[model samples]
Target: MATVPSSSEVPPLAKYLASTDKKTRDKAIKQLAVVLSDPSQVTLPHSDMSKLWKGIFYCFWMSDKPLVQQALASELAEILLEIPSTSMTFDFLQGFWEATVREWSGIDRLRIDKYYMLVRRFVNASFRLLMRMDWEPSSCERYNSILAQRGGPLCSDDIRVPTSLAYHLADIYLEELDRALGISPEPSPSPAPLSTLLNPFFILAARTPTKITYDRIQSVLFEPLFTALTPKPDDQPPSRKKPRLSTPTYSNLIANACLSDPKAEGAVESEKLRKALLRRIFDVASGEDTRDANRRKMYNLWKSHMEDEDSSGQTAVDAS
Candidate 1:
């Protein structure tokens, strides 16, 4: 029977790292530091190497192994920063972060906390990278390819990379790209109208007892909506026709806002706020000309309810 060769028999670089000799180990570490720090060399494909990429990723995610973890993190950061194209770099980092998140579940709480810091670092890095991408047809095609090939949208089996994170990352990527390119980030080809902006607050007031002054309503909600709704002049068609509103519909926005802040306090007030907001949304849906009629009917209904609530002195409604 043939005996397997000891690690000492391997090439000097590998042998030094795997060797027990202090001098050899130190030399290997220094060489690795150089290779890892060099972005071009690090990304070069080493097809014959067994699990080299996986091992690097493992070191990055395993914070319990402090020395290895720090080495990998430093190298990863350096490589990411050196990449010229923000989109490609961001996609790579996002994939890496997703893998790290999956690895996190089995880690101890203390280590998990440290890993969270790494996660934040990756997120911030991704955000910055996104700021540099061209959000044109080419970038969209690239994103669609990644989403389709990675099984990113429908799966969360891997904790390191959840579908929600992937989706949000894509959105942020596109949004930043649009901003950088001076284009509208919205999918619709048209720009939103001013009346569409005020629709939600109208609907919500009719549905609940919450009464938000226009100023508070604008501050809390409309500003963000307007930013997203308003399109760049260059994004409009060459014909100069009035562009249609392309902002997210009221219900979708409400749902997203609620889901975003699930633990927001003052549940009763929150519900009222949502309802008031929804009313404005309905007006938007109904069109500007019809908004007055809708508002009057809603106001009458709201007044009747307010009187009843005041008469009964009921602070909360019973669900059952």
Candidate 2:
């Protein structure tokens, strides 16, 4: 038998993590969960965690069938919950985020949906973990900071990750928080403040360098409210049913926060935006003659611009 000399080689777990055989991958993940749940077994540094995430990313990449991918995603996110310590959980999450953002550009349309679901699952799991921690202020801030980081899904610093991921986050955010809070054990936990729940958005709006990205975030966060508050034209027929609103109770709170949160903008700029949005609401509600025509026109133009971008293949990025 010929012997091959070996120096540093691939980690044993990496092979299994990327295995195409379903059982092999599942077994590897379960073992990983155990190790993560017990810090004494393995202490993962940032670099090690990052390397592990590459294999885990491929694990999801190699998975076929939506149902199977979903199951795998849930299992992977659940690993965070299994981790014994807060620091480990945060490290595990940072590794996951870095890996996803690092590889986001290569994801194709066919595989994109699964990855989006994976992001949602991980996001929900994060909230659950925070709830488990009693939503400690420092922990919550750290969590939001990760999401708002330069290469994070929220993508404040660059366009490397498409804004679609952020849009999806905005679309599902409040509902996921509601679900996380609802599932808390009896003698319900003290409510996490609306301000904290909305912090990530404030940070993104405050710090995003591009107008397009800011407009995109603004539309996703507040457009529904604009629709709900606007009155239908007299000539238009009544709708069959009222549309379901998105976190309607928080509508005022979010608006006020956007206007008042010093972190979101300077006092002057915040006042200007506040007045602009308020005027838009009044104009939209009054059903009068072309009062908010410029905003309406600009909004339509932005919509068209987004469509053009999407057609040019700027759709989604995986945060898997």
Candidate 3:
């Protein structure tokens, strides 16, 4: 309901933009992020808003200070939820993607917490947008346009999948999938299908087969998720608990995406991928590392899913 700057205060916002001090510029970016998060302020047209975010994005992009970009990207989750329109969200996504491509590995450069927050919001905002709208049509349209839409992929062609971001997106999707499977201490009363819930990542996986490689599939996606599925020692505080990996749902997402992709061959590759996935899952779930009830649940799901896959003649014993 509030405006960023009532008519007269606009000059100060602009002046802050030009300030030489890093502190002043950082504060300006922070305030701009907050202002952009509001959907209620509709005075500015969507096209202009897109450019506004673009301008802000480039400021972060060109800035020598990495902290400034992290500060802006951190606001993405909240802004994603409150953005005025999907069009504008795409602009923000594009800006974020390009900035990431320039050099923004979550664990390496930025602190995990900052990167973690961005991923969590990005994935959730993506899914929420997909679920609310008929993205298939827009995706189809954008694909044919031949003009790259600003910000992340709206369609296959407009899509440019960053490997680092892709893996993190997959991680967040899997984590949410784990929660959706009703494995946690408090599962959802009504859960969405894994395919539906993780549609955004599926779109990414489907589009970016080239970027989503074997090593990344292991190191970035499976390894971290496997670690999370591994239950912590009971002596540890409940606050430190990792997410319970829903192996069955996890298997389902991969199978559905791989099978559906024209690039990914049938049962053979998908099965191999599944087995590789299960192998890591087995090590963590069945490994005698931690003694927690989740280990058994994970193993049981893995065993049952394997049987189902084998019965269908879709199970391949290959490393992912």
Candidate 4:
């Protein structure tokens, strides 16, 4: 493995990181990960860390072809795992988010999909790092704070942060968590902090700079269910739409099942989290006066679901 240069020569490392030659770029990344994992060996100040991430951002930007991009994204995310210290892992995660946010608006249409993939891989990586720690409360709380707190990446008041990032984060939360924990429809014991897993969401709902972003985030989270309930323009008729909603689970099977089945085996803990998330959405929708048909339809569906459950004499999950 090629070694990193001395601290004084660090500035030029970005060239190596963004090299078209795979072998050169790969060595730079590995060496950078080693330095990050044990910073005492070669101290990198905050500014240098920021610059290195810029190189990494473009490293992905210059990545070739879909398969290569996919592999590179996974490799980049795995850096978080390589770090022996949790504190440095978060620093790296924060650096990644900062670099991405700074450049998000500049991403053009052609390259947008690749950046989206990059974000998804990072989110999954963050979850994997947490799961490795057994979802320790302080670690989860710290991670959530970094992502959703004021001035943080997802919930920052800065308009430059872009609503799409928050929307994407919301879109992937359940999917990635399920993926990270290997969750499936089959009954399995819930992980610890399972109930509080979504506390970041409520923080996001309250702190995100704009209502538009919040609505977008909320819409993405609930869209799977709403989409299942909704029919396409070319639908045959109302009769045919029943099959769509009853499809057991659409693309988001595990999450949809959690919403539809109150007594889902091994879902007691997950159910609490799901209900709280839905309650937040429902409460927000209730306050809006707009009668957009889809919003109205979604509201009614939730209302009916909650009412039926309430009348069934099932104990209500406190969504506080």
Candidate 5:
């Protein structure tokens, strides 16, 4: 008699994930998440494992279930952190973000919150991973492109939460860089510190309120005002052209300042500063000039700054 294939030999995980029933599909997704979480426990062969994950992603992309999408988002973040260099992970994340934005544009407030959290987790993890690998420029561009797109009427509002989350991620990026350079991660605890204007944007973005409030306006719109108002370092030369803030950086700044900081206390003259910075950013963002030209100018400025910092470090090393 011919040998028969057992249930154990079948790809139950993938099959279950692709099921028509919501309950069965969700259970399978959770199981897959667990398996992916601990690869050692996975009994599936390597080839089969690849197929299973691909199927899972397909299901993830095609399904309309928010619960399933949220699960997939968390799993994707974990996967990105677990395997930062995988091309598959990158492709999946890029596709996932695109799909998420499309779906998000059509949802109500509750759904928006759910989608925001899911996307935030993945984006945050990805940023941290990319920074750890010394991949800054690409990371910045990836985030910027996502935010730059104008969704429908809700698009602007929807972008706010993600923007704030991105800001918090940038803080982590800066902290990691400091640690790598053997510097203290903690800034001075002075009253009205520069960080006060910077730290909260990310947190706010990650936790944007479902209900609109006056506080939201202050946190999400006005707080960044303080950051812009505070003087750029004299040593930090103005771009011979315009300088572009990376998406992650810009998002982080906006979220922390505009979305998170409600009271806007500190730096006695913060209100004045906030207004100035807002005006400048608005001008650049809405300038009559082409968007591409504006972006190039911004990129050159950041590129130059990176070059300057690198050169300064090398010089110090050579002298030592």
Candidate 6:
């Protein structure tokens, strides 16, 4: 007698993932989509799943098809919501993340509006995982220190994708921060410090001075710090407790990212953008005012760096 297949045992999605033809691979994508569309499905084995992810990467990397990639991203977003799947995908995290970046980077590439919607899907998916439980995403710490070096080949790739993605991710990151840090009448639970959460993004903002990246860095990171550290009306009593993370994590992360980015090559520009951010960190980190004397002294270090840069600029001018 023939037995019926159990729910735990379904054909692996890898079969279609390996197909040579685009149509066949698309069929596999649709099949994965069908499975992910339902929350009850058990995911395929890790090896097969990685293969499936790599296959998706291969399909995108090897083709000129943005639609295919968009479909994969959309489906991956749903899969993540259903199952904790970043592990399989994270194995190739850079490639996985860069796929969309490369897609949307160039001026003549994907439409910004549509690209924005699609990128929202990607960043949101990763961010959801970032905030889920034990720890924040490690992408930033893993990448920031080395991104400008030859180690960060992707950073050198045009910078447009980084600019665009960084801009949007900042808003989302800050929005999440705001929600986590929003004022409450009673003591509220604060999420863990996003420590390195925005690090990867600030590297992008730092590595290049693209207008859009600059805007996002300023608005998302700087403006929010300013507002959060702003003095409240004295008439209103401080009813809520301070957040678990406080404002320093955000301020320090942005400042460090800016300072860490390599200076522009062969350029005579002053460190205006980087210094502006570092200098403000002094005020923001000062805690509700300059009352935090320790934080005030923190800016002294940056002040010395600014003077050093000024001296170097003058020397260069004299030599020229």
TM-score of each predicted structure versus truth: 0.35, 0.67, 0.44, 0.70, 0.39, 0.46
**lDDT of model number 3:** 0.45
Residue ranges of candidate 4 with Cα displaced over 4 Å = 1-9, 20-22, 38-44, 183-195, 207-211, 223-305, 311-320
Q: Which ten residues in a row have the lowest lDDT in candidate 5?
A: 311-320
Model 6: residues >4 Å from true position, as ranges?
1-27, 33-74, 81-86, 106-110, 136-162, 176-190, 209-212, 229-231, 234-320
Better of 1 and 4 by lDDT: 4
Model 4 C-alpha lDDT per residue in residues 215-293, reported as the tens digit of each score: 7655555544444433345744454223433332333334322322223333333345445545655554444543344
List the pairs of residues colliding in candidate 3.
94-151, 94-152, 276-320
RMSD of each candidate relative to the true structure: 17.1, 12.3, 12.6, 7.4, 14.8, 13.7
lDDT per residue for candidate 5 within 1-320, as digits (tens), equals 32322337437776776677777766776665555444343233344554465455445545576765776667656666563234444544554555454444355664555555565666566544544433434544444444333431112345533433343333343333223223213242112222322323322322333323223433334333333434466786664634335312232332222221223432234434344333333334233442443333323322333343333422121101
Best by TM-score: 4
- CA error at residue 193 for candidate 2, angstroms: 2.3
User: What's the true lDDT of residue 51 in model 6?
Assistant: 48
Question: What value of lDDT does candidate 4 attain over all alpha carbons?
Answer: 0.63
Candidate 1 residue-wise lDDT, 1-320, digit = tens: 32322334324455455555545554654564454444443232232122222344444433345665554455555455555443434445545544454444466656654554454444334323332342233443343343333333212232334433333332333233233223324332121111222222333322322223332343334444433433336755453323345533333222222211223421223344434443444334345433343445444433333432233533332211
Q: Global lDDT of each model?
A: 0.38, 0.64, 0.45, 0.63, 0.42, 0.44
Q: Which ten residues in a row have the lowest lDDT in candidate 3?
A: 187-196
- Cα error, candidate 6, residue 207 (Å): 3.9
Better of 2 and 4 by lDDT: 2
Which candidate do you rate higher for TM-score, 5 or 6? Answer: 6
Name model 1 segments beyond 4 Å from true.
Answer: 1-53, 61-75, 84-91, 94-98, 134-137, 140-320
